[model samples]
Target: MLDPILLWSGLVNGLLQGAIYALVALGLTLIYGVLHIINFAHGSLLMLAMYGVFLLFSQFGIDPYAALPIMVVGMFVLGYGLQRGLISRASHGRDENILLVTLGISIVIENLALFFFQGDTRTIDVPYAFDSLEVFGVFIAIPRLIAFAAALLIAGLLWLMIQRSDVGRAIRAVAKEKQGARLVGINVEHIYAVSYGVGIACLGAAACLLMPTYLVYPTVGHAFVLIAFTVVVLGGMGSFPGALLGGLLIGLCESFGGLFLGESFGQIGIFLVFIVVLLFRPSGLLGSRV
Candidate 1:
């Protein structure tokens, strides 16, 4: 039988990891909800943000946590410009076209990272990297705890923004009915850009949270693309609540799977869950059928 302490530890770690996954998914779901674009570039954008964190830390001696606002604002601007100048114009308001454009953007980003940073994996050496907190004999990394808290806080803030802000209302209007939103004096295109910017901004926060423990590389985004998509689909394409729940569930699956099945086969659980959800509950746990 598995030790209860080890099991609890795995569960806690999974929950922490899942929170970050959900954070990544939030941006993706938001973009899909508002702009109706798959954003194939989402993972690439995340990798870019991670690189930004790496550069800021290595070159300027800035702490990853301290770089949070910088990365968020910088990514938001990048996202806004991409949507306004490139995606919006290049896509011609077609989903397939947008998909291609985003894929192209992903390719470009990966190549740019390769050209600039090379393909070697990079990691930061923060003082607290080796620190941990023990609770009832289950030890948790301090970084993991901080990440968990930040992820939830950011998710809560995002929910509030969507629910209470004027710009958020315009975003919702555009998401529901672009023509109607335009008729009401809401700038549909600008809302699209803003929504895209906010989505990418989530990645900035995620990068900051992940950098203390995770390594970065030109193709690091690939590690997350499948999992992020799984979270989004398992939660429902456009449901933020679904994303949050799905992330936690997937995280648990990963932790327990790794514990029992060993590293080689551990990922089987995530795939299994994805397959089951697709077969039985394509709308996701909290999402409404489209």
Candidate 2:
């Protein structure tokens, strides 16, 4: 039998990590929802943001948190341009064409990072990196907690934008009925660009929050992109709240599976749950049926 304390600790840690994963998953789902494209390069965009934070910290003495606003603006511009210059051209193409284009973009970005930053791993160390808080016999890493708070704040803001703002309504209108939106004078192309920009901005936020806890490398995005895809699929594609719930579920599975079944089985446990969900609830836990 597992020790109760150990189990509780794993659960707490899992929740914290899940918050970070939610950020990434939300970004991917947003892009998919609006653009109907899988964005194979989404993780590579995150890799770029991670490098941006690292450079700001190491070369300019800017803290990762302080650099977040700049990162968001810069990533938004890049994402907007990519949509306008490249992705928009393929928007009308078949799904395979869009997939190929995005895959190409991902490869280019990865190689470029490799050429400039090399394959060496990099990390940012802040004063709070090693700090922790204990509550009810459970220890929580302070950095993780901060990241969790930031994730929830961003998620809440996104929810508000989607629910209350005119731009958000426009985005939803385009996603739901592109032809009707265009007929009603909505610029579908521009909305697509804005949606992509927002998606990448989410990645930027995730990058800043994650730099304190993880190492950055050229290939790091590949693993994260896979995990993000798993989260999106598990939560149901295009479901915002579903992404959060799926992330927490995956995080808990990884944590508890590692504790009981061993570290190697952690990923397997997540996949097992994913498969079960697919078999029984194809639309995801909170997702609406298509």
Which candidate leads in lDDT? Answer: 1
Q: Which ten residues in a row have the lowest lDDT in candidate 1?
A: 281-290
Stretches off by above 4 angstroms in model 1 are none
How many clashing residue pairs appear in each of the predictions shown? 0, 0
Which lDDT tens digits does candidate 1 get at residues 29-120?
99999998898999999999999999999999999999999999999999999999999999899899999999999999999999998989
Candidate 2: where are CA atoms >4 Å away? 90-92
Each prediction's whole-model lDDT (CA): 0.93, 0.89
lDDT of 2 by residue, 189-276 (tens): 8998998899999999999999998899998888788888999999999999999899888889888888878888778888999999
**TM-scores, in order shown?**
0.98, 0.97
